[model samples]
Target: MIAANARIGVARSAYFPSLILTGNGGVEAATLADLFKWSSRAFLLGPLAGTALTVPIFDGGRRKGNLERANAIYEEDVALYRQKVLTAFREVEDNLSELRILRDQIKTQGEAVDASSKAQRISSVQYREGAINYLDVIDAQRTVLAAQRAAVQLAGAQAIATVNLVRALGGGWGNATSPDESTQSDKDALTP
Candidate 1:
């Protein structure tokens, strides 16, 4: 699958690592759906689960999705905890994996960025000595700009990877301050 590799991207390879986090939205939605299923399952298979705890927040008096009274509380928070822990572990693992990939991508990009910088500098010196024309400066500037963009994108990737790890760690989402928030932002942007 495109997601398994994180490199089968829609954009250029230089930008794909950072863009991979966008894929996390899809992963999160599905995971949340599953968590909701298991969390609410306590009410469904009450006879088997045992005694369900009264989670006041999710099961309020609102007419929402399907769910009835707490039937048999699955006296095993361990089951729910197991589900949460494993899911969290997967998310964190994937995010960390992405971070490693992006880190490598950044290294290559950094080499490019450094080369571009040197080229630009050399071009500037040549232009100053009148060995080249204004066009030379323009080309150097363009290359530098492209390399800088790649670096910015990689920085964004590192940011996204950090946020994914935090989200898996069960932190809240927020603006730029948190990974969960940045993830929501990406998903929101992808939405209407």
Candidate 2:
């Protein structure tokens, strides 16, 4: 966008007058001995230093085309920038939603693990007292293990969601403010 804007400015400036300046200096020595001689030294200034103002006339629509192209490029860049910003916001929202849902799932899985652990303990006690078969104890233990594994998986998912959320935000959670906070600020600014 900046480059396009600069090109547009340059194209527009082509309509104004331009000033040019030129100068040259040299030495005319017959021999190397006279190279440093003041009389042998020759210089020319101001003879070619006069400013020439060139006012642009008609240009077969070249400048107009350039300006139009630059404007189009700038507009395209602005649109792409807006799209990228929206994509970033969408990713952040997605990650936040995942984190919310995963947290709830983790809590529920944790409760299941606790319940399964209690059931396993009761089954073991019953087996030792001959109130149940050994297979019941084994089954209860397997259920407890499955529940614990599920809880672990949910915790892992929550951690992954947190990482994704941080990545979407472009930095650590501690160093950045939430989008919700920014939205609140925007609302406050809009309030009378």
**Residue lDDT tens for model 1, 24-129:** 1111234655754533342223334333333234435432221111111222343666788898889989998999999999999999999999999999999999
Candidate 2 lDDT, 1-192, residue by residue in tens: 788778789888877898776565677899999888888867655545555778878989888888888888889988998999999999999998998899888889889999999999999999999999999999999999999999888888888888988888887657667899999999999999
**Candidate 1: which stretches are off by over 4 Å?**
1-81, 173-192
Angstrom error of the Cα, residue 95, model 2: value is 0.7
Backbone clashes in candidate 1 total 10
Stretches of candidate 2 off by over 4 Å are 28-35, 38-50, 172-192
Estimate the Cα RMSD of every predicted model relative to the unseen true structure. Answer: 26.7, 11.8
Task: Give me the displacement of residue 142 in model 1, in angstroms.
Answer: 0.8
> What is the model-wide C-alpha lDDT for candidate 2?
0.86
Query: Model 1: how far is 64 from its true place, Å?
Result: 32
Taking the candidates one at a time, how many backbone clashes does each contain? 10, 0
